[model samples]
Target: MDTGTHLVIGLGLAGLAYIDPVVAADPMVSTAVLIGTVAGSQAPDADTLLRLKGNAAYIKNHRGLSHSLPALVLWTALISGILWLVFPALPMWHITMWVFIAVAFHVFTDLFNAYGTQALRPISERWVSWNIIHIFDPVIFSSHVLAIFIWSVHLMRPEILFPILYAFLALYYIWRSWTHYRLESGLRPRDPTYEPGDRYTLIPTVHLHQWQIVKRKQDGSFQLGELRNRKINWIDRVSCAVHPAVEASKAHPNIACFLYFSSYACAELKEHAWGYEVRWADVRYRHRKQYPFVAVLLLDKKLNPIDSYVGWVSDSRLEKKLRMGGA
Candidate 1:
């Protein structure tokens, strides 16, 4: 989920806290809980500040350790303690409980998106992405906005409205999961030639009827396509064999970091007038017939990295940047 969705859900959690009679009776406690919830919601993502160091550091660490099991406990305790100091009259237990809920909810929701969090870190570093929801879902965001508006207008009580809204959202998640399962099952390749390493990954788009699909083969090739109204529209196939240039480029920091972050990474090696260009891309996200998340490395004839970049850039801009000698 995006920051806006997380914040709105945090506010929704605060509203739901009013179900407790003690919180409902005290205005100061309610205000204190609101602050705790909102802050707790955004705490895990504090790792976003790593961008100050560079994209490599940011890519390697964002949502890696910060969204782990240990981080969740730390965020809850730190946020609750800070709020408790500001509102000495409120019960510390109440503050801790709500803050814990808000922090846990943030990690849980992130598991459904394509760029999932390392929520199971310490136990396992593997990324757990259900691939059932987009990073930003209009339905989830707008529902929270509408519910907040209704609460603001005093059309319904917070305690009553939020519980109902959350129940509907829960059902919505289940429905989305079922839809993904059905689509994946229908697309599963039954050919005996399909190697054990071959697999299909379905990534949801903003539109419910549309999804991005990646078929990764054992040979390090990828078939990118789109699923619309139960039909698969094949888009692009990236078939690149192992090459010395591609192997050498992986030693560069930018390319290494991009490989670590990308699940369906593919590399293309091209000989140029100056040297060689090794283009690595994550095939999971395809927009406007372009794979924007990429890492490009220019290597000399001797396979030394001259210059490199690792970030999101459109195909056209990437070409311009390469032509300008990594400007």
Candidate 2:
């Protein structure tokens, strides 16, 4: 599931029972639920982080800790406890309990995948990344998107179908996972690379119409080795990002945060609401003396992107000209 799908599904599950009650009851509690809906949203992408650092150790260290039930419970309790300690007059229990319930449900939902979550970790250092649906399943994600769109424009109430649809999705994946496992079991001896270890994510490559397994190698390192896709031999050679084109962008804190917050696939550091700061190469304008282009953006706590058009800045040549004038 994608982050947006996690959000939608989390919201759907949280609101399933309490929607009518919360709406009719105290407005504050309703707002709490809304906040909960917004939180616990990002899809389980602990696996993707492995690719980012080009290793499994980084993901393993951080993934289970933050993504686990224990962490979620402790965090929620601490939040509630602090609230209660600070404002003893308020009913912190309701707030804390609601948040816990919502967030716990969120963590629980991640179990359906081939990479199930590290709900019970330390005792088990395994990282879960389930294979129920592709991490970026357009079909599953679109359902959440369509439902969210309907909610955004219209007063959409929680429907039973959401749960049923979600349940079916989880079950279907469970069955498919078994089938994949059976196929994988039969073929592992033939394919010497198929040593099963923890933190494995089995993803279905859609174009090839076959299942592929990405397992953590015994060296405690994760490898994206090909597995069980020989039936449909078309394999993608495209590897993950080797280098990030953000050296210039990294120099500016504002631009860096904008990159984090705005979720712009690529961020530019050159020009903003205030003025021009950094420069980079891009397709729109390839750093000429005359033409100037810049964009501004903001990112939220959840790293969702928001973009704003800002004033342009001088190109490098013009900047040099300005420096000469000042001198």
Candidate 3:
């Protein structure tokens, strides 16, 4: 989910807190909880500051450590404690409880999207993306916005409204998950060569009808496809064969980090003016105009490394950066 969605969700939770008569009776307690809700909702994303260091650190650690179990507790405590410091006269436990709810909700909702958090870190380093929902769903975000708009006009009581809104959103997730499963089942018969455990990575797009599918086969080949109307349209394919040039390119730091972060990565080795260019990217994000996360390593005619550009580069910027890096 985006930051705006998270912030609105925190506000929704604050509305729910009003259901409790004790919280509703005290304006100071209400202020402390609201403050906690706003800050705690964005605490995990503090890792975005890593962009200052460079894209390498940002891509590698974003949602990895920051969204883990220990980090969740740390964020809740730090944000809640800071609010307690500001309003020492207020009830500390009540502020921490609401703030913890906001922080926990932030981590919980991230699990449903394609770019997931490692919520069970230390227990598992595996990225647990359900791919059930788009990172920014119009339905989810708009519903929250609408509720806030209605509340501002004094149209209804938020305590009664938010629970119903959240309930509808839960049902929406179920409906989307069922649709995703049905569409993916249609792809299996198209390629009967798949064996058990060779499952396709099916991700939902903003458009309800469209889905991105990336499948890896046992024969060292991958297929990228789009699913619409229960039919798949092949977009691209790559072989996982170990070429000498591709093998040597992985020794570079940029290429190594890319492989670690990409869930369904594939590479293309192409001849270039200088020598060779090995391009690597994950098929999950291929729906974008320019692949958001990619690595390009250029090698000389002798197969020795020339230079490389890695991380998020748009179409127009990619060529210029590669040229600059190689020089």
Q: Which candidate leads the pack in TM-score? A: 1
**Candidate 1 vs candidate 3, lDDT winner:** 1
Predicted model with the maximum lDDT: 1
Candidate 2 lDDT, 147-258, residue by residue in tens: 6565556556544445555676677566766766665555545555455553444455432245654444455333343454444222322121222323433434434432
Q: How do these models rank on TM-score, best leading?
A: 1, 3, 2
Question: What's each prediction's TM-score?
Answer: 0.94, 0.49, 0.91
- So what's the TM-score on candidate 1? 0.94
lDDT of each: 0.86, 0.47, 0.80
Rank list by lDDT: 1, 3, 2
The regions of model 3 sitting more than 4 angstroms off are: 190-198, 288-290, 301-304, 324-326
Model 2 lDDT, residue 273, Cα:
43
Q: After superposition, how far is residue 144 of candidate 2 from its true place, in Å?
A: 1.3
Reference-based lDDT, residue 158, model 2? 47
Q: CA shift at 315, candidate 3, in angstroms?
A: 3.6
lDDT of 2: 0.47
- Each prediction's number of clashing residue pairs: 0, 12, 0
